[model samples]
Target: MTRRYCSLPRQSVPAFTPGLAAERLGALIGGRRMWVNGTVLHYCFLEADTDASVIPVPGTGETRRVPWAGAREQLDVVRECFREWQDLGIGVTFAEVSDRCEAELRIGFQLGDGSWSEVGRDALSVGAGERTMNLGWDLTEPGGRWTALHEIGHALGMRHEHQSPFAGVHWDDEAVYADLAGPPNHWSRDRTDASVLRKLDPAEANGSVWDPQSVMQFPFGPGLILEPEQYHNGLYPPGSLSPADKEFVLRWYPPADVPAPLVPFRSAPLGLGPGEQADFTVAPLETRVYRVGTFGESDCVVVVFEERGGEPRYLAGHDDGGTPHNTGLRVRLVKGRRYFVRVRLHSTWGSGETAVMCW
Candidate 1:
């Protein structure tokens, strides 16, 4: 069979507006619509300040229940994406299993419109009827296929490529605001800032360099970018995953390696207060990005260290990340080394809880 490439127009393409979809699902500036544990959590609120009034759930609120018939067709596409991940050694699986079976993640359309998936392991937080992924729209073409792969990328713990702090793409902010606020996406200033202008922190930087052609990246169209001749006109249609996409999956989800923890090392719901810190130890393992985040309203700072002779040696530290200032760090730990993780409160808030995770 011949392949159909994603040919979303440079402007006014609704299907290409995944960020807008996320905004519609109640993800405010710097706040995640979905939460991460060892799996994705959909139809559930993770942060304290999240607005629950608009969340779509069956027989609740004013939103329509998911049309499972349509959802099943989309599941076929999701399975294809899963197969690709499995082929690349990422140990994730997607299928229509019995509701009684204990599964890591459950995806459906019990939420707001468009295609969206919780980042990585946040999916484990929902109930059977609730969805960890939503296909508010239908999957009818090759673009649907690309959408499936892009969302599954999130399911695999990868973030938006354009948000990479190192991408360095000079966005024409005013033009971006103007363009996105009209036509298909009538995003507000805060949503625009969070979705388009917000850059991932240096600590969240993964892979070697930015992959503009990555499926996780949204094409900016003409006049949206102002730097790097390679990106001034926006990227060509991301019909499929770039080489780096595959490499990232293989590197993070090596089949031979033991699976990382399914749950967080700690769940600090109240958060660390002023001058407060928490410590944890890591086992011997190759270097990879470990995430530390506030489930509540506190800003967080994380420091990684190696214990030596009744002392501590610093290895890595990060303050803000994602659009919300969550923290992430990539570090290498020795097998028997006792590592101390110091989680500190960075906001004026008195106290906030945190969750530390590795995968």
Candidate 2:
């Protein structure tokens, strides 16, 4: 399918209702905490008495200091925020790492200017297995607290909340684009501003339809300065979370599943070189546990193939129980070598763990 993109501006406050519900469900499923697989976070500490508004950027390899009280307060709030997710089954926690921190699972913090933007340069450097959140020195200042939360969301690997699928309901694409374009980062591309809209995983498409009220969502614009109608419920700030957004986060990434593994178990290839042909088979560890068939009649297996890079190519296979209990597939590989395969065991309950194989 062709990738669909949406044009929307980022919001300051992310929607929270959907996330709340997802947390509830996760707790019921497995007693284990949901893990956020990839992320590396860092924070800068400041003194409580220091002026956060005029904070200066920290020099490289230097730790800007924050008032003991201020740092403690911010950390407390942050800890509490993550605790909420943890309670829901998401496994979000904090750790202390110095410069030795690496990408796999390392994060560090430094105290410096929050307004200068540059001070938090690597603040968004989260990768697989690591995520980062920043605590600006001026967080105690008015509006600064919200900024800290917004940045933290990013540190948690969430794109602007406004990018939620439901954003199309409230956003006036042309108007918002006119205002957001022509900056250090132009919001021209449909996918540029709306990170939530992007397809991070195929499951998201099947799960909740779409929601705009997720706490991970961004507001129409900063609280003031730009009072777009979407910001409020026709006339006032619409504070309630959207059903879809709330359901999405809460259901997908519950607090109990903090540090959850967000890896793609099953993946299709992008492109394959011309005249190339590949075939493979996988046997279920326990065959009797899973029966394959449309409606309990005959046994069968399903195979799916897709081209990744050059052009979109796909195929599927169904094998009768006669063939050594294994299903096979063959495809004509195209130039550019971008292709992958995925296998599914369709049963009465539901599909699980799409076994992915590539060549």
Candidate 3:
């Protein structure tokens, strides 16, 4: 018998504006959201001895463990990919079980939360120093390595590569994601909310160009599998990490403090003298950018600077939690000749009315 799959509703195209350069820039810079500190993650692994037609997961329950032969090999592959981050002085350790550590990362076989598709469930769960990752067994099938890598990227707080600045080059949303998979299933208000937060979080980087070969990217579409230039019989072959991917891993996950260029922007500022704060706006000239959270959330802020003659110059500084309806910056300016000032805003999943001040 032929298997049947549920088809999702079509998505509406984002209306394109003619000359909203800042909006465009915001989209670009916003694509590279960062993770936050004191953020913990949990991952669960499920194994089935017999290659069952499907895997099962409880919709709401503590993580469980199963047995499978491919678990170690799969873990090794993930470790190899993550080694790059480790080298970058980023801390990523593994624990035996969910309770063993404050944060958990789960992996398993099959698809769905036993109700719908596995990928459809929340891929990452964020809590106070705790988050969770669910890696389904379906990803262990032959040729599913790319999916494995992509999900791991999410576990590491990385967003979809298609959301990257270089997304224009690789993304053919209509063709590639025509039959998209998993929950947060289609782009809805909830999905948009998550995307907005992921984009602005300070732990994410800003101004970094999207690396097409980053393991975080999907390998089945456009330049990824089928290069626009090298069309092979109207079909594109699967793609993997390029030299750049290896380099990024090595550099990002350095064993020590990697002497990398300073990220061009800043998060919202803090510790303002009573009644003294900075105000700004969210404007992306040619890139997608976000404002880090301040006030009620994390304490970090983001700022952007321009070079003036020989010294770096400040353009703007933003404060957190002024108001949500307005994305403009609001802070007290001190007696100083700053180059310029602007503010950016980002949204979090459960936290309401958070702000990040940036210049």
Candidate 4:
């Protein structure tokens, strides 16, 4: 039997009403970004010597101490995965950081905790010093490598492909629970249900065709899939990212071609559709505090990055999720330094062309 495992990309937010859930999941659908103002995200792992499981085992205080050897292997795989995704030229970029204070994606490798990551920007809501991603199983093996890819997809705001509304997969819930309880997974019934069995709302599925081979898909075993009869025997996603995954990411975060320039104290029309973002290069005249904000009643995510040696570094970000007020970020800007502001519109209410200004 294959040593199968699963990636549980759980939401940081607890259960809520369906309407609110979709509303929240909507932002993630567009990609759970750290304000995706096209900032370069930095990921770091907990020190193998100091960090322990953030979630205590429900009963026993027994926690895992990630082995440095395996953690080292996991780190190499993650770096490769980061470059793989980066090579695609998608809206995302990543860099490894040593300090947790400077990292947005804080990864932990506590064995027995099971593999998982909080979806997208939800990482921000996590406690300042908590693990946002985990790799419980050894990742040196070929099969285990996929877990890193899948969890990173989650961190980028991708949902489970098997749960896609268009997937048309009918799961044998009992069989799923029983199978996951053994060997590689060892997930409890609740974990299985939460990560695998639950179907997503169509709105959250991005209205795309189901791609069984997507890296975001879990490996389904025989007797686990009972629908779409052709796959009834089993469903196995290609261990690597699929073509569909690439296309979807590219479409959502299409290249800016050339970013627009936004002058200080001058407003620029976003003229962006919902789920769309605009990028601008902002060069300040003096070294001082600068404020960037979007006007009009809208839901937006605003992020500012400092251009350093051709790489953009995340500096500040803010999100207004379907709120009455606009979103803004204030930061100290230095003269002779190049900066950029990325603003994504979630939705505009009672208005047309949301505009942003830096002052």
What TM-score would you give candidate 2 relative to the actual structure? Answer: 0.37
Best by TM-score: 4
In Å, residue 333's CA in model 2 sits off its true spot by 39
What is the per-residue lDDT of model 3 for residues 1-359, given as tens digits with 9 covering 90 to 100? 11112211122222322453443334323322222221223343434344233334568555544433245766666555444434444423323333323224545433332111112112322332222333444444554565555555555534444344433343233343332333323444444333321233222332166554555543342322233444312332243544555454333332322212212255543323211223333333333343333444322233433334422233433323222233334333232222233222332323444444333
lDDT of each: 0.52, 0.33, 0.35, 0.76
Give the runs in model 1 whose Cα sits over 4 Å from its true position.
1-72, 92-96, 110-112, 126-129, 257-359
Q: Any runs in candidate 4 off by more than 4 Å, and if so which?
A: 7-9, 13-37, 54-71, 308-310
The TM-scores, one per candidate, come to 0.53, 0.37, 0.41, 0.86
Model 2, position 304, has a per-residue lDDT of: 38
Q: Which candidate is the best by lDDT?
A: 4
lDDT of 2 by residue, 70-103 (tens): 4456556555544443344332333333332322
Q: Clash number for every model?
A: 20, 84, 71, 2
Candidate 4 structure quality by residue, lDDT tens digits, 118-219: 877787777757888887777887677788888888777778888887888888888888888887677788778777888886756634799888888877
Candidate 1 per-residue C-alpha lDDT over 1-359 given as tens digits, one digit per residue, 9 for 90 to 100:
22222211111111222343332222222222121111211122111222122435557556632343344566667677667756665423333334422334455443234456666534444454444555545565646777777776776666777778888888889988887777455567776776568786553444559887787777667777898776777665565888898877654443332222223354534333432344455554544445544454444556665666544444666655323446677766665566656554434332434565543
RMSD of each: 14.1, 16.6, 14.4, 3.4
Which ten contiguous residues of candidate 3 have the minimum total lDDT?
A: 1-10
lDDT for model 3:
0.35
